[model samples]
Target: MEKKPSRSTEDRGISRARFLAGAAALGLAGAALPATGAQAAADTRTGRPGRGLTRRGVVYTVGAGETPGTAWDPARMRADIRAVRRDLHADTVDVTGDGVERLTATAAEAAERGLHVWLQPTLGDAPQREILEHLAECGRFAERLRRHGASVELSVGCEFWLFVPGIVPGETAQERIENLQTGTADPEQVQRRLTAFTARAAAVGRSVFDGRLSYAAAQDDEVDWTLFDVVGIDYYSYHQDPADYVRELRRYLRWGKPLAITEFGTCTYAGAPQAGGMGWSVVDYDKDPPEIKGGLVRSEHTQAAYLTDLLAVFESMGLYAAMAFEFLTADAPHLADDPLHDLDMASYAITKPVRDRPGDPASPWHWEPKEAFHALSRRYARAAC
Candidate 1:
């Protein structure tokens, strides 16, 4: 990865003390605080305490194969959850799944093991109708889980910003409408859809039982704020200075809702070339090799450093929740099976290699805890107690 000169060192005479003083004057707390009105409303909707919710919960990025009785044996899955709970001293685990049944069952299992569960389901490339149907399905699923006496703390559409019509990689508003046959769809359409979805969920809660539902969105866009009870942002370690990334988060706080760092991890693929002729050569940050045709690939040590710095900022922010990007991945074959995988893909596998050769296993990419992980775990354990 081409090293951008660290912002921590500007040629200007300003020192770290001055910067800290400025940040303190800004009234930015990296961790929890008294709930604002919007945050209280969101907490009511989500069935979580608005204040003191930042027990520094663990966000486990679960894959399809790692579920109970699947790629991981039931015993192993339970044991892993137990181990994570013990290690992090955390009681909450966020899980992603395909549908309501799978997610509800997973949540129930975790709840049985004394863990609060958050269900995350990706609203795939389905059109508007299908998407609404899926939301209704989620409502029904939440009802069923409640009937079964399972306590699912939250139900959020995973990567929801990816599915918003006008947004996303390709497809314009006109194209999205033609595809949906729905009326002219814009950001308003996206917001309306989300509002209706959440409204229906709240209605279902009133009719049946109450459950929390929100959407997890990438922190990239300003318009995403209008859609949810609680705001969710995926904070990554792609930036040079983690503090800069946290500063960007202040804009989202304007929404006045409780915020969650729903997905956070240091990318291990820094040396990969920029995609689609973006015109950046990928170089290994560790080696600083001349730009090969590929773009910059991040090193494992850089990844750990990024996480540590970012987590410190998060700790100072007093946000509602911050979850690590992932826990583990299937073996390399499984990783290869993911079509999204490419040279530049950001994989959080703490156990994978950038190249076939033996890379830095001690790097943040390895499964073992690094200094950053220990620091975060200690912080979380302290906060939880």
Candidate 2:
């Protein structure tokens, strides 16, 4: 079957610095209730969890984590962490981006909030020197957080074959995906290259960051589990089958190391769980001013159920931690009747993005919490109880 060309993520001309400067004060304050088993996992005094490394987490991404030109809003980033901590009741947040400065700034913000930080600095197919440079800065971020008695972990990178150059014979992630599917890329060679670099990163990271360390691995990658403290996977459910999903998860148990889900979530569209991560491309771009191609209904309920079902698996399986794919997916503001163009439609964020409304004085972007937000909060509260 011929795969149709994908409708690329529409670039809404939001400048990075413009958004950064403009989006600083977008948070509504609220006190967070403690999370379940968080105290048991970290020290009560410093609020530094992860002596045992258990976590309830969400990936606080800026610009989908992979989109080029993604920048961070220091104030909004801090506020999002607070929202994740307070709103979601999640104890940890995986701050992901390819920008080293952005990642370090995020770690500082997370530290100030007394929240556990997973600094996942992405490597965007750069050279060895650049990769090492990013790793060194990440080490500094981790060390600084530790000095302040904050819990921090450095995920060297995620899914190297897709992100790093020279590991696979592709110029772009999409090309690599196609190469893998078409049997043009050698899987064994890719694994070897990825493993070699990962080992090097672990050594560099350990030299400075005397805290926990792991990588956000894709499940299919043949990695050496012995090198790290925790085994992380970007596991998403296509709802292939609940039984089969659990069976695949059980396969990780053979490694005997702790398991962490680094990413997972569905789009807000109806029947999204079945579509999985690709649920966002609801447009056929062959036509000028691409038209909405999906026939599915818009269903926040489907997204909520998808989240709960996966969390249920993690809870029953005694996995280390599961970070939802994200806290904020896109910075695009909502426009009425333009549902297809609304960036939040493709986002896994639990908050629906809205423009400035009357009576809300903090900022231009207003985030309306979704059902998953409340569900996660309640679940975390119950677990903590």
Candidate 3:
């Protein structure tokens, strides 16, 4: 993706900054509530929780799956971390990728920049033993960071039933999801398997990383909250109403843990808020160069509005943290030529990744911030102030 200068917040004219500032102030002024058992232990280790969504963050995937094109260049990785802190006013970052080395390097970069790190090593579809080993290795590295006074947490795994084999009947994630949807995968059995796996993962994490333990659960994942310090959910707003979010989120509070929305954001297109996490399905990969299915309109404002509105909901709900789904998606570059070929429309990233000209040897692929970037910049900057 070709890098470009970002537009200023003043130029974007986003109005949510003041709203966010006021909301944060109100939250801080509210009477302090008694800490839950999980929160109490966390407080003992890391001090009390702040007002609302104190860990403002974005999920930055350094490398995942087979996308070598998205691999992190050390210099570019540092630049992105700096932007998350300086430009977005984000105090936390959820660093996810495949390898231990890549994940550790990225987390260290964010920590060095004074941003809290959620070290999530995403080794999708690997053997259970391999995944456990991966988490243990990453946890050890995170322990080193914590000992050195860096604010860091280790997320053992994310949505393992879909990503990890043996839990479900199918070999691949798509197949497992399909089988589950078709009722071939028994829900009760799946829950039992997930709970058992989470217990083992938590044990491994606790043995190495003493900072904090979390797992990024799917919206419906019935995780055993007793295994974690912070209950993490990858929340996407399929419904627009705040009441809907409140109703759905109330269940998590029963666990008596500080809830963190580890992932939240929609693609850059009209009706993406309704599409939620599946908004990326609009692209037809069967084509030589994949194109959008059809008729979807590109609307940066829709993406911006959805994110800001959800941020308000998270803040009002007093979430411990809410990480926007992503900062950028290098594999899904923006193509200005045609609507059908514009892959950025399906990305949740605040920035539109653009590749260099076809034959330019000196031009490196880079990114330019979208309207959502400016909107979030305003809200997060004001909230921090």
Candidate 4:
């Protein structure tokens, strides 16, 4: 992997000024920063509502097979995770699933190697009953892991906001179906469901390990700062400048909850002439660049640079933890394609042609580490200490 270029003197000068400005605003200017874990946690949670638990370091994730299959070779998965740990000096990995069996096994594997595990549950397109059942199942799994002396740092419902009603205006029944299919729903209803699910999860946590429990919100709007132990947001800057992205992040910081960049990435698709902005283009990755049948272009160095800048800002802001969107995949390029692109369904994907061609599993973007991944690993390695 290539090393991230060192910041120029001028860039460093600007960063120093920004840092000082932020410090002064936060009233930390000229104060001796807490050096120990207990003090650090206290500093972070003093005025905050929930228990103060600062993340040990940055966390990253990789998806297993789309559905359960031998496609998720345990040895290969372990090797990839081990390589990432060595490269980034990271100590945590996130594994997502419907229940705890797979997650428990994965966590056990990670623990043998001394890495912390963050478990994420995919709350499929089930109604309230199913969602609740899934949460209960996760609680049981969490208890099992705790019994084995493993700790779970976070529990996420991958994309709950995408299923809520009225979050985005759906003009027709097709649009409505598409919205629900993608899990986009009204923000208020999202809050209700989130509150209920989290409260239930909390009850489970009390029965299990004494560590923290948190949910990964799809976007800032989906985040109920008051309800969650940590404030989690996804940062994909392909559509917006890094500065503007950080500006949006400021809102969550005010809630005083430790923040996590739960998911962040750029799509391969470039902006469309008719597309309103970069944000819209990224959000609808399967739609722009009309000439490409699948809608996505190959990932670019520009995307990597954007990620580098975004991480720098997060570090400067003193964020609690951050995780990249994903690692390797059995579905490779188009794992996120179906619900993202299906135009007949509501067209969230920037690319068209939802599925990859038969036998050729390479995603439109493929799995080779882009400049962004390399840049991210280098930054994370340096930040780990």
TM-score of each: 0.58, 0.79, 0.84, 0.61
For TM-score, the strongest prediction is 3
Q: Under the 3 Å rule for N, CA and C atoms, how many clashes does model 3 have? A: 8
TM-score of 3: 0.84
lDDT per residue for candidate 4 within 1-385, as digits (tens), equals 0011113212211111121122222222122222333432333333222221233233333333333331445665567566556764556676665444555556667666666777666544345456555666665666566667775665645434332223233532234334444557564664676566555555554454356666765443444456457766644333233344445566668887788876554433343211211222222322341112434444445445555555555655577776654454333233344434322111111121223352232333223454555776766565555
* Model 1 misplacement above 4 A: 1-53, 61-76, 127-151, 164-209, 222-227, 237-243, 269-299, 331-346, 350-375
lDDT, candidate 1, 10-84, per-residue tens: 232222112112222222113322333454333333333223446355555333432222243444456656755
Name the candidate, 3 or 4, with the larger TM-score value. Answer: 3
Clashing pairs in 2: 36-384, 42-49
Model 3 agreement with the true structure over 47-100: per-residue lDDT tens digits: 233355778889998664224555577888899999999999899999986788
- Worst lDDT run of 10 residues, candidate 3, spans 1-10
lDDT of 4 at 83: 56
